[model samples]
Target chain A: MVSSFLSGLLGVWVIGVSTIDAFEFEDEVERLRYSGLIAEFRCPKCLNTNLSGSDAPVARDLRRTVYRLVDEGMTDDQVRRYLQARYGDFVLYDPPVRANTWILWFGPPFLLLAGILVLRRIGSRMTRVSLSDDERARLEVIRKQ
Target chain B: MKRAVFFAPFIGFIALVAILYAGFHLNDPSHLPSALVGQRFPGFELPELTSGKVLGHQTLLGEIRLVNVWATWCPTCLHEHTTLMDIRRATGLSIVGINYRDDGEKARRWLSLYGDPYDFTIVDANGDLGVELGVYGAPETFIVDADGIIRFRHVGDVNDGNWNREFLPILDSLTDG
Candidate 1:
C-alpha cells in the first residue's frame, strides 16, 4: 500500500515538473528543435538570460513564436532569420561574421598569435644571453674557488 | 626596434584605455538597435483600445507618425504621457499607441484619467504585436515614414532633450523630403 502511494506521489511530481514549460509537441524532433531554439536565443528584455531561462513577457512571446514556427515545419535557419529580421542580430547568441563583426571573431586568435610572437621574442632573448670574456673569466675563477 | 619593443606595453595600455573610453561614450548598451528600421512596419491585425473595432497595418500607412509602445504597468509610460500630449498638441503629428501586455479595462481608465494623446491606440494585450516590433519594454517609440517604412526607433522616454538632440533631425528630414 505504501509503495503504491509513493508511486502515485512520484507520478504527480513528474507531471508537475514537466508542465512547468508545458508546450506540447507531437513530434520529438520538433520538440527538440523548439527547446534548442529557445536556448539559443537571448531574451531581449533580460539581457543576460536566454529565452529558455527568462520568464520575461517578451521571452514568453518569442518562445511561443518559435514553437509555432517549429510546429509549422520551418527549418532552424528560417526560424533564426525570422527572429533576426525582427530583433536584429542581437537576439542570436552567435552573431554572424560580417564586416562589423570581423573583429569580434578574429580578435582573439590575432591576440593569441601576437602573444606567442612576443613570448618567442622574449624567450629568444633569454636563451641567447652571452657572457662577455671578462665575465666568463670571472665565472671560471669563481668555479675554481 | 628595441625602443618600440620597450614602449609596446605602454602603447597597448593606452590603446586599451582609449578603446574602453570610446566604447563607454559611443553607445548606450541597453539600447538595442532596431532591425525594422528602413523596412515596412510588421503587418498586424489588432483591436483598437477603446472600440472593439479590429484594425490592420493598412490603417497606419500613408502618414509620417510616431508609434509609441506603452503600458499601464510601466511607470515610465506615465512619465512620458504628458510629453506625448504636448507633442500631439504642438505639432499635431499623428501618434499611435500600442497598449502592450496590459489589461484593456485598466488601460482605458488610465488613458481617460491621463488624457489620451494617441490618434488610435492599438490594443496589444497579449503583446503579439510587441514581439513583431521587437519591443523589449514600454515607452519605446518608432518613427514611421509616409511610405509605412520605419525610419528610426527610440527606446525609453521621449523627453525634450532627446526630442531635440536625437529625434528632431530625423523628423525634420522626413518632413522636409
Candidate 2:
C-alpha cells in the first residue's frame, strides 16, 4: 500500500512537470483558440510546416507571440491581422482574396465550369449523331442473319 | 463558337507553357515579399555589437544604406560577406548589420576574422527588432532610402550578378531622386 501510494505520487509529479511547459489558459475556449491560431499560421523559417508543427526558432517565437496576443484579450481576427502586418499574408494559410490571388481563388471553379460545358457539348454531340439509313439497313441485315 | 471551342485547349496549353516558362525565369518562389517596404524602418534602441551602447533607428537615417540581417550560425551570411565587402569598397555605400540571435563573442570573432563591411553592427541578441522587422532568417538585406523608408528587400545573398542587375538600379534611382 505504501509503495503504490509513492508510485501514484511520482506519477502526479511527472504530470505536473509536463503541464508546466504548456501554456495555461483561464478557460478551455482560450486554449482551443491558441491551438487553432498556431495551426493556422505557417512557420516563416520553415519550408511548409505550420507554427504548431515546426521546431524552428522563429516558429517558437511566433507561437509565444500568438499566446501573448490571445492572452491579452485580442480577438482571433485581431491576432491574424497582427501577424499579417508583420509577416505579410504569407503567414496565413488561407490567402486573402486580392487582385493577384483571384486566380488562386476562382481558377478551379472556373476550370470546372469550363470542363462541364465542354463535356456537355461532347455529350450532346454524341447523342445528336443520327444513324444513316444505309447503316440502319446494314444493322437490320446483320440482325436478320 | 464551335471553332473557338475547338481551339480552347490549344490556347490554354500555350498560355500554361508561357506562364510556367516565365515562372522558371523568376526569382525563387519561397522568397517572401517584405511587408516593411515603403514603410519607415521600425524603431529600435538596440545595443551596438562592439560597443554595447544603445542606438536607435535615427542612426540609420539621412542616408541610402543597406540593413543586412546576419548571424554567426548562418552559413549564407559568410558566403555573402565578401560581396558586401566588395560593395563597400567599390561604391562606398553604407551597410548596417543586424546580428540576429547571435552570441556577441562569436560575432566579434567572426567579424575580426572576416573583414567587417558594416558601418556599425547592431546586436539583436533576443531578436525583438528582428520580429518587428519581419525577419524569418538571416542574410536578408533591406535597402533603406534617405528618409529611412525601406525601398526594397533581397532575401538571399547579394552577389555581383544580382548587385548589378537588381540592387544598383534601385540605388541609382534613389540617388537620382
Candidate 3:
C-alpha cells in the first residue's frame, strides 16, 4: 500500500511539480501533506492550546508559510528555524533559549524572586512575636526532659 | 525622576496587559475570540478550483447557514457528508462547503459517490482562501447566520449530537423570530 501510494504520488508529482520549487500539486494533497506537520506545530501566538490556525490571523499566516516550506522539501525544524530568524523566537511555539535569549529566558524566575522578597517583607510586618514563653518551655522540656 | 512619575502606572499597566495577553494565549479558544455567539459572521471569499469564480459568504445575511470545509481525500469528511445530507433534508438551512486544497475532478467524484448538500461549494485549491478564512483542517464546520456573522465553528467530524443535541435546536430557535 505504501509503495502504491508512493508510486501514485510520484505520478501525480510528475505533472504538477516543476523544478521542485516551481511546482504546485492539487490543493487537497498540499493541505493533507502539511496537515500532518501543521497540526503538531503549535502556534506561538496562541501557545499550545491552538495549532497554527484556529481562526487566528497570525496562526493562519504561519500555517500557510509552514505548508509552503514543507512542500519545498524542508524538514519541520528547518521551516521552524527560518520562521524564527524572520519573525524572532516568538514565532516558534517552543524556542530554545540560551545566551541569546537571556531576557525572555530569565524574566519569569526574576519576577518570582521579586515576588518572594515582597511576600517575605509582608509576612515580617504582619506577624511579629517569635517564640512565646509557652513555646520556650516546650522546647526546654524536649531538650532536657 | 520626572519621567518615572508618569511612567509608573503606564509601565505597570503594560506589564499586566502583557501577562494577561500571554495567559489568554496559553488558555483555550473557549476564552480567546469567543464572540461568534453575538457578533457578525466571518466573511470570506474563495474562488472555484476549475472555474475560479467566487462562492458563498454573502448568503449568510441573518439566517443560520452551515459552512463546512471539506475535501475529497479526507476520510473524516466522508463520515460527515451523510450527516450533512440529513441536516439538509431535516433543517433546510443553506449549507456552504469550502473545498480545501483538493483537485476539481476528485472533489466532484467524492460528491458524486455519496451526496452533495452544499448550497454553494467554494474551491480553495491553494489554501490561500483557507488561510484567509483561518482554516487549519478539513471537515471544519462554521454556523453562520443571515446577517453574515459566525454563530459557531466546530473542528473535525460533526457528530450526531452536534446537530440532534446542540446545533439544530439552536438554529431552530434563531429562525423562530
Candidate 4:
C-alpha cells in the first residue's frame, strides 16, 4: 500500500514535469495558448504522432478545436470527455476501456498469457524419481558445506 | 480470425507502444515543430503584398522579428489580431505576415476591419512560403532571432494570455542581450 501511494505521488510529479499548464495566460500576443490541453489526452488513428496535427488533417482540426475549447475554459479532462461524448472512447488520447477499446485494455495480459501458456507447454517437464545414492551423497556434501 | 484474436492482445500491446511512441513524437502539440527550431532560416523570395516587389531572407536578419502565419479566412486569426496589435505597439517588434492562401481583396479587407499591425505583408496564396517555414495552419507564428535562426514557434492563435505569459518572457530572454 505504501509503495502504491509513493508511486502515485511520483506519477503526479512526472506529469508536472512533462506537461505545462494548459490554460495559464499572460498577455494576448503569442499563439499556442492552450495547445497542450487536448492532444495530450487524445489519440491519433495511425500516425506515430499524437492527435496533434500529423499528416491527418482531421487530427489537426481536432487539436485546433481542443485549443479553442481549452481557451474557452474547458479543462483537459473536460475536453477529452467532450470528445468522448461526441466520438466515443477512441477519441480520447489515453482512452478508457469500453466495447471498442477491449483490445487496448486486455491486450497485455493476453500476450503474457499466451507467452506463459507456450512456455508452460514447452518448458522442462516435471519428473519424479527416487534420488540415486550418488546424487544424495552430493546433496549431503553440499548441505554440510 | 480466432488465431488473430488469440494473438490480438500481444499485437495490441505492441501496437499500443507504437501508438504511444507516435503520440509523444507529436507530444508538444507543436509548441515547436520537428525542424527549423533553433536553426538558420531558409531563404525565400516573396512578392511584397503591397508593392509586388520581392523581399528575400536577407531582409529578415538583424533584429528580433516576428513571422506571423495568418489568413483572412481564419476566424481564429481574427481573434488573435488585437493581441498581436498590442504586442506590436508595446515592443515595436518588426512584424511580418504571410497572407496565407488568401485572396488579395479579402486580405486587404481583413487588415482594414481588424487593423494591420504588420510592418511587412507577403502573398503566400499557394502556401509555398508556409511550406518552407513548416506552417501547418493559418494562425501559426514564429519568433526569429537577429541571426535569422528561429527562436520560437507557436501553432495557433496568439491571444492576450499567451502574450503576457509565454511570449513576453521568451522574447525578453531572446532580446536581453
Instruction: Report the number of the highest-DockQ candidate.
Output: 1
Q: Candidate 1 chain B TM?
A: 0.94
Query: Which portions of model 4 miss their true places by more than 4 Å?
Result: A1-145, B1-32
TM for candidate 4 is 0.52
Model 1 segments beyond 4 Å from truth?
A1-19, A131-135, A142-145, B6-10, B21-25
Q: Tens digits of per-residue lDDT for model 4 on B1-177?
A: 645755655676787789768878765643433355787776788887777789998888898898898888888999889988988898788898888878888888888888889988988776656645655566988888999988877778898777778678889998687
iRMSD of all candidate structures? 1.7, 1.7, 9.7, 12.5
**What overall lDDT, based on C-alpha atoms, would model 3 receive against the true structure?**
0.65
Candidate 1's docking class is medium
DockQ of each: 0.52, 0.43, 0.04, 0.03
The alpha-carbon lDDT assigned to residue A11 of candidate 2 equals 51
Span of 10 residues, lowest total lDDT, candidate 1 chain B: B5-14
In the range B1-177, model 3's lDDT, one tens digit per residue, is 644643545565579569768866784553223223554544556665445677556745655688898988789999888989988898687888888878889988787788889876888777665544445557778777777766676767788976777677767776885
Better of 1 and 3 by lDDT: 1
TM-score, ranked from best to worst: 1, 2, 4, 3
Error of 4 at B176 (Å): 2.1
lDDT of 3 by residue, A1-145 (tens): 9988996797576434311223354565665556555555566445454342355544666665776787787876787665554334444456577784665677667666656665676577668857889999998999996
Minimum summed lDDT over a 10-residue window in model 3 chain B is located at B30-39
Please give, for residues B1-177, the per-residue lDDT of candidate 2 as tens digits.
Answer: 986986675576577568768877786767988887898899999999999899999999999999999999999999999999999999999999999999999999999999999999999887778888888988899999989999999888898898999899999999998
